[model samples]
Target: MATDSAAWICAALLAFLPLSTARAAPLAPGQPAPDFALRDQHGQVQRLADQRGHWVVLYFYPKDDTPGCTREACRFRDDLHALLALGAVVLGVSLDDSDSHARFAAKHQLPFPLLADPGGNTARAYASLWSLGPIKFAKRRSFLIDPAGRLARIYRKVAPDRHSQEIIADLRALQQGHAPRP
Candidate 1:
């Protein structure tokens, strides 16, 4: 009975720990964003190094067309022009393959590149990969990389419906040489 009671206490303590604590610490502001070369939906390679001198919104999603992922993608799609006007380029990352990304992009008419991270390397580098048993998925997270390739901000818990607008507001503030809102 004592052994069982101890085990239950351990389990309860573990359950209270935030999932983020189980993974690596996310890339914080002022850290250099990790460079990656992954194939986009169009089968062309996209590299982070190539995006230098432009603000890059690197967002990771769990699945290609799931409800939350779809909402996030469509939100980005709806705000593409405004993002572009701010000189920001949005690139989405997922553990799904290129074929899946292509279908998702087409279904939503997404104007941005959805990069495929089949091996989850980029996702892991960004501390956005979630694994359970034999399945792996990318967490819903976003990194704002500035022109110098440094992380401007990191959004660990993203609300899909409002994330695009949030980023846009941040970009506007950042571009005007003001600190972004918390």
Candidate 2:
């Protein structure tokens, strides 16, 4: 009976462990961004290699159209022109299907591509995939890839409302040949 009670306590504790703790080590700055080809909201294929010569904002979110995810997408939408002016393109990735991405993009009027990573392959490559039992999702992480295809920065924890502005500031600093803030 004592063994059974101890096992139950261990199981309870394990159940409460955050999924983020299970994620693989994320790619570090200066590492080459892992190349991938995935379908975007419009069913168009987007490849990281094709984005050479441009700054790429590769963000991974947990789900499509959720509260925080929506806020993040809308923030990017609002800042799309500013990002473009700095030679950057934003691409949001999530473990959602194409149809879900389409709706989310249309609803938010996002000009950038929201890549459908249904199988979480791209997220796994970035080490941003989070899973709890049979349920899997992407962590709220962002990677800034330089025009040279190297990772310029990685945001391990993101604040949805402020992330876009933060990226813009970083881009400006990078463009001015100054190192981004730590």
Candidate 3:
């Protein structure tokens, strides 16, 4: 009876607690990047397994068309060719639905995929989701997945203005057989 009462109390307390926790620890470098299947702005299903043999830039942003998100996305747009030349594919993920992504991608002329994670499962897998009661959004984070589908680096603190450039430089270094300083 005592143990049952304690368990009941704990469950009741948990129900009353604020729902602000992320899913799990962020994946470490060298771990195989989590596999995800999500529909992009065009309703095309994209899978991480398909991106093998090319560097994958998997970036998670908070919303569609917001200022910081725009800046980060446009920078990637401007540098897309360079990144492609270096065998990289950029993927942007957010909690927005496909309709929102279509508008945002059209408005910004983004050439890459902006994946819809309306349920935030992908963001949660990446340890990038933030929740407050009923509200949730992805934090600004990026994962650099190598050609073998392993995480090369994880950017927990991102500066939107120079993030693409930073990735470009890092890709160059990694391709040249040196550890990226950034």
Please report, in order, the local distance difference test score of every candidate based on alpha carbons: 0.91, 0.91, 0.95
The digit string of per-residue lDDT tens for model 1 on 1-182 reads: 99999999988876765444126555679999999999999999999999999999999999998999999999999999999998899999999999999999998899899999988889989998887545688989999999999999899889999999999999989999999977
CA lDDT of 156 in candidate 1?
A: 85
Q: What's the TM-score of each model vs. the native?
A: 0.87, 0.89, 0.89
For candidate 3, lDDT tens digit of each residue in 21-124?
58776589899899999999999999999999999999999999999999999999999999999999999999999999999999999999999999999999
Error of 2 at 40 (Å): 0.6
Q: lDDT, candidate 1, residue 3?
A: 100
Q: Which stretches of candidate 3 lie over 4 Å from their true place?
A: 1-19
- Clashing residue pairs in candidate 3 (N, C-alpha, C atoms within 3 angstroms): none
Task: For candidate 1, report its TM-score.
Answer: 0.87
Supply the TM-score for candidate 2: 0.89
Candidate 3 matches the true fold with a TM-score of 0.89
Q: Is candidate 1 or candidate 3 better by TM-score?
A: 3
